[model samples]
Each structure stands twice: as structure tokens, then as C-alpha cells.
Target: MHDPFVPHEMADEAGVHPVTLADLVAQSDIILPHAPATSDAPLMDAGCLATLKRGAVLINAARGALVDGRLPGAGLDVFRQEPPDPSNPLLGMANVFLSDRTAWYP
Candidate 1:
């Protein structure tokens, strides 16, 4: 619950205690990165992923991720490399789910 756009008062009223981004990711069972990503840094990297609680799930709304190693499960809507290479480990994980950013035709 760390949205800078979210007024402190609104968050408090909703019983959401906004915490430091690192702390939120480290503590949450389910993490949803609620911000947009920049070209300078990925929303989540291997280092950040390593800090997460074991068995934690990462849900990437649109932010890209560069991850290597294990995850209990991951739901990613974006990747550091679109249509990631066949050798990418995340692609081989049974617990990881990935989707394209594009909307489907009717």
C-alpha cells in the first residue's frame, strides 16, 4: 500500500498503512506494483525479488521484471524483455503465469 498519489488521509481512512516500497515488498504475501516503470530501473529485479518473503507472490500490473531463480508463483503482465526468450527461466516455471499487454479483438 505505497501509492504516493494516494493521500495519506485517504489511505488512513481505508485502514491501509502505507509503508516504504522495500518494506511492503518484503512483508506482503501478495505484492502488486501499483506504479508505472521507468527505463532506468526495472520495477523488480533479482535483488528485489531476493528480498521478498519466501512463497510470496508477485503480481506485476505493467512494470517489467528481470528475475532469475525461484518464486512460489508470479503473475506478470510485463517483462523486461517482451515475448521473453525460450530459455528464460520464468517461462519454464509451473507456478509462473504471463500475459501480453495488448487487448484481444472482439
Candidate 2:
């Protein structure tokens, strides 16, 4: 898992927190953690989604593939597909916060 989303300066330009995704989910209003590469179900992704307090927002400003694609919840922003499959469950969620694929680009 990547480090917690600490400020770059506190991270000393390369400072990585010793925290896991579970730690961040347990500590913040917004949960931003990476998905494991080899898991078909993306356990961390599912766990974080489940761990989120009800009505919480999930912001995926990175890759959409990290999302489990089959979980249920909201406040989710996923752009793995330019326009995700119409049947994608994430689109139907009310608490989700979706953005076009390019929203995060500079």
C-alpha cells in the first residue's frame, strides 16, 4: 500500500507514512488509497468502501481500475473508462461524486 496522503513537505519530498489503506480509512473524511495489483476483487478497495461511514465520499482521482467494479457505495469518482459501461453500478449510486476522465489532468 502507498503512504497516507501526508503533505509532500512533511513527507520530506519522499516521506512515506508507515500507514496502510486501513489506517487512512480509519482516520479521514476522504479515503484515498491504492488498490492491490494482483487481486481480482481488490480487497483493500472493498474493505475501504465498506469501512467508510455511511454518506461518506470516495474520491478516486487516480485510476478507475482500482475500484472493485462490483462493490456498492457512494462518493465515488472513477474514470477507468472514458465513459464507463452504461450498466456500471457506480453510476447509479446517489452518494458518488463522479468526474470526467480528464478532470484530474494538469
Candidate 3:
């Protein structure tokens, strides 16, 4: 649980050990970007993905724009464009796993 916007007290109440974004990416074996995608800025872009430890896996149940195709491997459920274009780099990567957005719907 690494969210700078979350107050320390709230984090404590939630029983999550909050850390800085940099630390989270550097230390995590699996990164899950759960933040909402209302902001113009992407939470995780190519530069941020490059900082991830080698062999680290990214699981994006949030917005697809949060991830860059440069990653070695990823599990993606959403994309900037639903049913991404056939030429999307991520769709061609052998290590990338893509699931339909509705896979999670109940």
C-alpha cells in the first residue's frame, strides 16, 4: 500500500504499511496499480517501469495507461483503448498477459 495522498492516520487505520512510491516500486516483487485514472498524469509510465527491480511483475487491474510496454512481463485487465489496436506493442509481447476488461465483472 503506497499512496502519498493517503494520510498516515488513515493508512495506519487501514493496517497497511505505506511507503513512498519509489520505495514501493524498488522493493516490491509484484506491483499492483489500483489508483483511479482521473488524473492527466499516469501513475506508472515507461520511466517508472524502468525503476522496477528485475523480474518484478506488474499487475494492472486499474487503467492500462499506467503501464508501459517496455516491461518484461505484466498482467493487464484494462487498456487506454478497450480492445487495444492489433498493433499495440503489449499485445505482441510474449511475456505480457492480457485479459478482457469484463473478466472481473460479477
Candidate 4:
């Protein structure tokens, strides 16, 4: 499946063009639906990491395992484990931006 991470492009453009990982790596920032894997003990496997754009900002407000496996510099509001294990690599990544999941609601 080809998924383009372009900002103004439609989903069809991405899905139809077949953007490879190399293409994405050439760009900056990626917005994902979940967090990277290998966090917490029972690490979930997520393949979206294959689509990650190098130096991209993964936006995960959906599932913690959506972007698992590959390390990303992202804005994470959630994780596979609530109150993510302190040792998660993302915590040490200089580009990561984190927020408590509950901060989004009343």
C-alpha cells in the first residue's frame, strides 16, 4: 500500500501513487495513528513504522501500537502503556513531544 504523508495531498494521491519508505525518508515529519513498539513488556507490533518519514513528527492519539518497532521523533499523547515505562526510547529522543492522554478532555 502506498501512503503519502504530504500535507495538502488527498488520501487518493498517497494510496494510488505508492510512496515507498525511501520516498518518505527523504522528507521531514510523519503523523501516525499510534505509538512505536518495544515499549512496556508485552510490546505490540505495529507496521505503520514502515511508512514513517525520517525526522518526522508522529502524531499518535489513536493506539499505542500503531507505530511500534521503529523509533520516531514524535508528539505522543498516548502509549501502549498508560504512564509509559520510563525506559521507552521515545522519552530520550530529543524531537519527541509528549503530553498526558487525559489532558485533551474535560
Evaluate model 4: give its lDDT: 0.57
Candidate 2 residue-wise lDDT, 17-88, digit = tens = 555666666666765645434444553555566666655555565566666633344454555565788887
For model 3, what is the error of residue 19's alpha carbon versus the real structure, in angstroms, after optimal superposition? 1.9
Q: What is the lDDT of residue 88 in candidate 2?
A: 74
Summarize candidate 4's per-residue lDDT along 3-103 as a digit string, tens digits: 33454356556555445544543453654433234345322234545655555665557766544565645678867777899998778888778888668
**Model 3 shows how many backbone clashes?**
0
Q: Which runs in model 3 stand beyond 4 Å of their true positions?
A: 13-16, 102-106
Best by TM-score: 3
Q: What is the TM-score (0 to 1) of candidate 2?
A: 0.52
TM-score against native, each model:
0.62, 0.52, 0.78, 0.46
Cα lDDT tens digits, model 1, 16-94, are 9988777887888987666655456665667777899977777666556434445667777677677787897878778
Model 4 steric clash pairs = 29-56, 29-57, 30-57, 36-67, 36-68, 37-68, 37-69
* Candidate closer to the true structure by lDDT (higher is better), 2 or 3: 3
TM-score of 4: 0.46
What's the lDDT for all of these models?
0.71, 0.58, 0.79, 0.57
Clashing pairs in 2: 11-15, 58-75, 75-95, 75-96
lDDT score, candidate 4, position 39: 44
Off by over 4 Å in 4: 1-48, 51-57
Root mean square deviation (Cα) for candidate 1: 3.5
Clash counts for the predictions, in order: 0, 4, 0, 7
